[model samples]
Target: MINNMNKFIAIVGSNSNKSTNRELLKYMKHHFQSQAEIELVEIKGLPIFKKSADKFVPQEAKDIAKKIEASDGVIIATPEYDHSIPAILSSALAWLSYGIHPLLDKPVMITGASYGSLGSSRAQSQLRQILDSPELKARIMPSSEFLLGHSLQAFDDNGDLKDKVAAQQLDGLFKDFLQFVNIFNQLNNAKEINVQKAKDFSWDKD
Candidate 1:
């Protein structure tokens, strides 16, 4: 069971630089500032995933996996490139599929902003499809889509979310996301308790 005091959340993005996606994640962190510990995962050092090298994934990948395992929920903010999620995000997700499967049954939410008319909605949709693979086991938040358009002009040079309406929409999305995650956590705790009770009964019968 996750202690309310110890619960943590991880926010991930594709770019290592001052990306708009990262800025969105920063805003998310601020929204949750008083509620939970939010850790931003850096994908800069993660290597390209290779199937043959299952025995030794890169240290960076391992670090990310550990963080995912420790996190109570995950928020991803990714950019669109060619109507798809960035290659770096893809690589990280691919690497996470091996061994530990940190995303399995984990609560996840996705949001993004773009300079184009479609925002990063196309890329976010592609990522949702990828995350829905049977192997992932993610409890995806359906209502948490934040597709901010005109990304370059949406924020000031200081990286604040400039659009008041967009900010409010994002806030609402985060509130829903928090409720979903809390319910998931409760269900997980109940399942664990039931399993422990069953195990205890079996031991007594023997």
Candidate 2:
């Protein structure tokens, strides 16, 4: 019964105002409130990362990156479009990956909802591979897949999940993710401290 108020940001991958994926993210954000301060985000405000080399990135994209960097962990909730993530989310990831790895060694959780029978499993898989690339190297949570299939009927009018099983799964996923993030952050912080100490060590003869 540990209580840790970690800050987290949820990224929604859809541009549609009526997207079920967005609603799914909202529900997950509320469910994680007890364990974290979760803020749901969207990529609609971010512009395409690159048109030409060394072009100025928009302030909106920078703002989103800042929020992600400030947070303890990240949750990416998206909708599968043609067996892949949507363009909006892709663009947002591009912005985050520009010139540097925004997710380097950062804790990341990925989930998605879709109308199809497999939900967004394919999309999440693709996202996982992308996050695991040497360039990004995000510490992704494993074995806790939160894929909500048949999402059109997965929620009630109030946007809360209707399936008790799904709710339970999400609860467990959130808890596990929180623990994972905490452990990783602790280790990363310790490493940073050691590195700082090493940098300040005196090798000169006084």
> Highest TM-score: which candidate?
2
RMSD of candidates 1 onward, in order = 7.2, 7.1
lDDT of 1 by residue, 42-85 (tens): 78678887766334677788787788888878888888989999
Model 2 per-residue lDDT tens digits across residues 1-206: 32357888888888888888888888877766666888888888777656455646677877887888888889998789999988888887766765445577779999899998898998999999888764456789998779999999999988799999989988888889989997887678544444344335332424
Q: List the residue pairs that clash in candidate 1.
A: 105-137
TM-score of 2: 0.86
In candidate 2, where is summed lDDT lowest over 10 consecutive residues? 196-205
Whole-model Cα lDDT per candidate?
0.74, 0.80
**Which pairs of residues collide in candidate 2?**
none
In model 2, where do residues sit more than 4 Å from their true spots?
1-4, 189-206
